[model samples]
Target: MNEMGKTDTVVQPQSSLLELKKMFFLYLPVCIGGYIVFRVLIVLPLWFSSSTEQLSVLRIIFIILGVGALAVVVLGAVRAPRWVEKPIHVHYRHWAPAFFATLVILGSIGGHLVASAKINSNLALEKVKAHFEKETAEYKMGRNAQ
Candidate 1:
């Protein structure tokens, strides 16, 4: 007979799949999301910009906006939407571990994109600006001579 004050509690160990789900949710949102967010919030805006002649104020503004997007994504562990949650629930049985492992193998490419966006975008623009300016100067000299 069990006493009213005593209760036996049963605890089940988490499966390996759950561990993979945990890890996938942990890194995917903030890291990959941050990279994707950068592409959207920063790089996309600059893509068609005409005045990329300098490391101007707009670049900084977009970077700050990207950071804001990254901040929102960082909370993904707690409150992802149903569209995303449904996949985790459905895939946990079969694909969660393999998917997580694949992400682990491929994660660095996204990281490199983020890093390259921050480092290379402005430099590339500046290079283009310099080449254009040189051509303009040469054209001006030829026109003046004629």
Candidate 2:
């Protein structure tokens, strides 16, 4: 105890924290690049493909990714304190929220686009069917008149 009758504490930053910070800085760029590559090479092409069945598969993929994002957020929340002390899991708690948000945003946008595309294609098909039916009916009436 000092003459002031108060406790004095000295705080020192842990080296593991520093290393985790370094790892996070390195991981940020890699994660962004990976996301971009996956989006361009896989997601965009699949989403925009002319094949109707491919959209179903793309929908499933986005659903799974969205679920995974939620899981990561929940897991991080439950394990954050312990994870912060562990070097291997330290940075995940910090990044999981961002990851979750990105997944959610992308999933919503993709879902909307897919739904619009399907609706437009169905409308076009219906229009074409109606035109064909009208033409067939007119031809039949002309044949009966003759």
In terms of lDDT, model 1 sits at 0.51
User: Worst ten-residue run, lDDT, model 1?
Assistant: 100-109
Clashes within 3 Å, all models in order: 0, 0
In terms of lDDT, the best-performing candidate is 2
- Give all TM-scores, in the order shown: 0.29, 0.52
For model 2, the superposed segments whose C-alpha errors exceed 4 Å read 1-21, 34-38, 41-48, 82-89, 92-101, 104-112, 136-146
Q: Which candidate number would show the highest TM-score if scored against the true structure?
A: 2
lDDT per residue, candidate 2, 1-146, as tens digits? 67899887776555867777877776677577646644553346334755556665665666676666667667666655655365653466466465645656565456646645775686799899999999999999999999
Clashing pairs in 1: none
The root-mean-square deviation over C-alpha atoms between each candidate and the true structure, in angstroms, is 10.4, 8.2
